[model samples]
Target: MERLHKLFIYRKKLVRPYIEQLLKWMDIITYVMSALLIMTLVYEHGFLISFQEIGVINRLYHIVWVVFLVDTTLHLLLNYSDTRRKYRGLAWLLSVMLYLTLIPVVFHEPEIQGGIHTFWAFFNSRLYHVILLTLLSLLQLSNGIVRLLGRRTNPSLIFASSFLIFILIGAALLMLPRATYHGISFIDALFTATSATCVTGLVSVDVSSTFTPEGLFIIIMLIQIGGLGVMTLTSFFAMFFMGNTSLYNQLVVRDMVSSQSLSSLLSTLLYILGFTLAIEAAGMGIIFLGIHGTMDMTVREELAFSAFHSISAFCNAGFSTLPGNLGNEMVMHGHNTIYITISFLIILGGIGFPILVNLYETVTYEVKRIWHHYIKGNKRMRRKIHLYNLNTRIVLIMTAILLIVGTVVIVVLEWNNAFAGMSPTDKWVQAFFNATCPRTAGFSSVGMTTFSMQTLLLMVILMMIGGGTQSTAGGVKVNVFAVVMLNLRAILIGADKVTIFNRELSHDSIRRSNATLILYLLVVFAGIFSLSLLEPQASIMALVFECTSALSTVGSSLDLTPTLGSDSKLIIIILMFVGRVGVLTLMSSIIKQKKITKYRYPSDNIIIN
Candidate 1:
């Protein structure tokens, strides 16, 4: 009795104080281990198939698979008391999905081929190859989710999760038998998933020839989610159904939208969301009527096609279900309907949302004033209501400049080179569409390879400049480029401050603008340098153009995608992700864990010529 009482007292003394402390330490260690596992997976590069050790590659993949499964199981068991079961359920679901997708690969016999890397040989499976591909894709998604979910709740987590999920679904779909699956290849599927999630339009296979109606529908959905960004869409819906949005969620939406935060961000987002859908619906209606009258499709098919194209176009996803892309139909018929409709859609979508809102408000205010004046028999009405905001003015001005410059350059340079065979009207239309689409829209009326070197260079410049912020379009953004140029001009003129359209810039805005410019250039250069090493024989101009297009998420390629090795494709993937999420934010996400000091040190200046 005395021993039992002493033991109970000792247990009581030992348990309570240390439990929470122990848990905290365990959480930290689990996070670190998870991160270390992710890093190992990234660097593994896996075994190549072919050559002497094809079987080895398959065995290695299986080993890695087993390792991940064990790790996942252990994590679930260890965290059972503190962590929610939902996480374990997620891990289980992920594992099941991966194993299910890889079932087809199990039937294939590995064959050794000469000169192939051992890792490549392991990936070799007949029809079952897709199984391995599907498993790898799911792993990526599961890892992304697990990583983000481990962190504190934030809006960025939502974007990261959605992006990963879309890729996983797209990958699994591609792994299905290609014949019944509408000619989809594993590479094409991965590329499409990456492009849509990144909102880059670089396609490995022709979208029109291969994708079934269901597949095309999937592609369109990706375009919409990718273009508007998943976080922005989800947050908008959340705000509509629920009155409140958390600050962390709002921050994620702002980052996704690339907004400047002039007013209540939630209200602005609501307006933008509602307005965007309305515009897209109207656009679909217009295009449907035009296409229905022109083509001989059934009503249901026509409506589906119209809706798909409208959403994709408005979102600037640049995906088309039509055979041979836009260039094909243009070849069949004269450049009359398709070019005009698509061009108009691209133009409207390229304009930033804030500008669209401003334009609507301006027009509505003017119309109301005019109506009131007419009723009272007043003489005049104002032409403009409240001067256009900085964002609006910059977008409009830069857009016009780029269009004019691009048109002139294309006409002058390509007139003799690629445009030699076309009529004057067709040539102009081709040039105009090419120029406009590179900002965001991926439509092409002419072969990319046919363009002159000068024209391609110009395209590189325009693509790097990209479209407006808070718009579906990607790139460095025209507004940022314009601000940088204006600042440079101001400095050259020896002005104390940068001025634009009779308004002085805020110091903070100018600093951010400059930083954005530098960061964008650095990213482009790094992409180009990396790609050049992978394909030494390719022209520097062509490689840079491709890199810029990927960085801009513009989807314009010079026919280099199909021939690129796995290394090059991975590099492009990185560029596309960076392009969608600004370079600044990507960098911040990496460095955010390290808290910076609040105190400022003394500053020093350097002289420049």
Candidate 2:
């Protein structure tokens, strides 16, 4: 009778965890909860190692998770001694429990008369082995968060932190009375949050049917916050409240959003926010006016839809409440006017904050100063209030070139392919929108799956180039692209210095640009390779296009994201984070700095082709 009672108590405990409902580091708590769920599954399914069994493969993955977790925990404890000390009592107990649980594997006996490795013996252990591994992934996440917190000035880190926080908030919102549904899992919530925060348009469920207006609004909020960056908003408020700015904060904003200088950092942020709101609000009004006359929705619904799409369009965030993703319904209903308006928003939003600021200042000042001179002031006495920097010039010039080139190339390539059946005007419009949107803005009037390989490749290139610096768009950056072009031109001309607009480029700037380019390419390749391993049957171009889109935060996909398994989705998430924050920032945060030396190293030249 006592044994039966004890068993009942233990079984009850199995279903319900003993941990209290604490919201300290909620993200870490959720992550740990997920790992525990995986552990429970392993414990339920006893170890049955066989090469052909999918269960065995999955079990091994869990085991690997364990080992990885341990290494991560040890590193965290060693590096973050302060945290360890603060939780010394719990740390000591956890340390002892950790080793004790691994003792069986550590001292396991080998099978007699067989040449089995000792490590393989540990692998054959029961499913309870995951307990140790669960702690490892948790530790890794914790350590990463701690390290990120240390580099608070980094723009990428600020964006990443915001993405994480918004995701948690979005998840909580979905779990409320309105958002929950039969098929919605917490994992799905997390995935959706990641997609919105990263501005990747991969949807696992039918977004229109599955999410309610409240839920959809949460998503739109995440996309808008994620698109402009959380820090960008916070920084604006900080400047507003303090009525004074610090150089340190300026540096933070500059690094966070890729700004050019400290002089107009606050103004730049204000302009970005103001410009974004104005454009999106205008877009919503335009769409509402254009569609309310004929659309099926009620007045409230129309207003809601207009507002949601306006934010999404300006943010380059491709989430839609309509099914099939902005299909021919809008066009057939004569709401094509909204499409053109959205295209304008996308183009303007994709132009980097720096370019936008410089353009505004230059044009506004030039016009005012010219008028002043014509109104009886000496023309020679006129002084320009705004000066365009090299970075600004490069971004503006390259952006114009890219927009024209991308439009022309897309039109030419799709002329005989996807655009074959459309009328001349519609074809041109579709091609133009496609050319602009895929670079960062993810809205699509045409089906991505129907595009030819050439068109897809062209999109991949455009997405990879992305938008301008410090803008809502992602990519290696237009300034970097411009610098590379200049460097190539210099090489071809046998010049020692790369100069543009009669001004010589700084070596440091060139080096940083080169580093950014190389790192971005490497990260993209890594994503491609990882995805390929998980999805062997997927096409190379499809994979490349998908990878590029995710890496550039351009949400266009060839109907691949929804079909990808958990592992593939995880890889995509990592790439999206990297792409949005930028590869160079991530690399700088990870790479340990070396000590400076007084002596200069000898220089040498290597032979080239």
Candidate 3:
């Protein structure tokens, strides 16, 4: 040990440079290898590995193991003390774990050799290999994400790029034979991937019939990731577990997650993750209870069905494992509880992360205050009048207004027409669900074609209006809609400033809201025009609904999605991508914004009306 230490220390100047150079090359090699490794696993998942392919898979895994071993060794040798101190010697321990992957290679004893053979058997087991493959790949993926963010890339561009990457990856994964019932075309795969990643429920093919359980899992995974921005999951896991990331990386993540300051970044991430899982779990349970013993499904099937819909509804992705979605006969008629539960889940998810965080804080404060003042009989209790934030207040109000108006309108117009056969209680439940879904949960219980023309118009408006900003749901967002309405109200009422809840709305906020509204309309119109040209056989109203749905990331369709041509599908794909990542966000990412000029143009107003 002393001689080894002396050798490394004595030759530090002579050997350190080469070691450093080797480490750089190894890092590049590791990047390439890690990507290949993941692709290999994906390929294995897509198809049944042949007897011949098994050997090849083993060789590839062994190669990866060797690379990891070398990398870990060099990292330890280069800065032994630093690594030992870092993460409380976690790196050194993981290196030990890596070394254990060679146990089978080290011990070649037969079964009769007792303890040595038993050890060999354990290490040589397929389960160990599988676990190692998964563990290493995840670590690599997390590390790669950290490294990518470490480079000073524009956050918006990174945001767009990451979604594209996931879409492509999902597309490839979906195409795997094992993922699907038979097989699907690349175009269909791409469309499905884009839809899933964008949390838009639109599908060219029926998800229930087209995909195997494996494929559905992949789609759900994409929904979860897409529902939460890509940067969010990667950054949280990488930084929290790995530790010692660059400060710039943390700051970038801080902005992405809407943390008020660096100090609160961790809590914000935790809250976002906690809210997502907890709500989804609760939704799943409620859905399960509502549909229990009704679907002729097994225990496992019931749970899967519940979990899938819960995630889908909360993500507002609109995808459903059921053939006709929530409209399927099993639960559509009398399982009114299911409809109400799903609608509430969609509302919660669409309300935005900021609001969720604000609600959490408010709830916790109230709980603590109540406990201290009432339970503990304390004389003093902390209080805050402005517990709810401005954004939160606006979103809640707009969401409430939209839901009530949508419900009332749908019920008044469709009470006798579309919902003829349903009981009075059932009619109200269906009406409420239908109204709530248009704000964009894509789970349709009633056929779109059966709706009155007036109701369809209302849906179009609601779809375009969409859900809240920084939430899984998409569209112009409730925030922008509220802002624009307030601005208009201010103008009509002869007030210079738009005031709400005793707070004045900023001019910048009004300007941004107007810009978002205009941009959204322009994009939706462009999509409609393109689709009309590509699909001349389709009705103008259907084209309008399709474009609105795609652009708004609302999965509702007028039975027009399956019939669209390839070109039309591509157009919808672009719209879904744009809608999922905000139109403003995509434009800001691509088009460079010139720095603000010191001088401003003379103020002027253009004639209107």
Best by TM-score: 3
Can you rank all candidates by TM-score, best first?
3, 2, 1
lDDT of 2 by residue, 324-412 (tens): 77774754335667778878777777777666777787888878877878886767765853288777777767877887887888788
Clashing residue pairs in candidate 3, if any?
none
Candidate 1: RMSD to truth = 12.8
Which of 1 and 3 is the better model by TM-score? Answer: 3
Cα lDDT of candidate 2 equals: 0.71
Please identify which of the two predictions, 1 or 3, would achieve the higher lDDT against the true structure: 3
Model 3 lDDT, residue 144, Cα: 73
- Candidate 2 regions exceeding 4 Å error are 1-159, 175-177, 180-183, 242-247, 254-265, 374-387
| CA lDDT of each prediction against the hidden true structure | 0.69, 0.71, 0.87
RMSD of each: 12.8, 18.2, 3.1
Off by over 4 Å in 3: 1-17, 81-96, 102-124, 605-609
Clashing pairs in 2: 66-133, 69-136, 155-256
Model 1's TM-score against the true structure: 0.71
- TM-score for each candidate, following the candidate numbering: 0.71, 0.71, 0.93
Candidate 3 — number of clashing residue pairs? 0
lDDT of 3 by residue, 1-609 (tens): 999998888899788789779878887787777788888888877788888998998888888878878877777778666555433333445556678878777766585878777777877787776666566556657767867777987788989999999999999999998999989999899999999999999999999999999999999999999998898888776655556677888898888888889888877988899999999999999999988898999989999999999999999999999989888888876688888889999999999898999998899999999999999999676688999989999999999999999999999999999999889898889889999888877889889999999999999999999999899998899999999999989999999889999999988999889999999999999998888888989999999999899988989999999988788899999999999989988999999889988998889999988
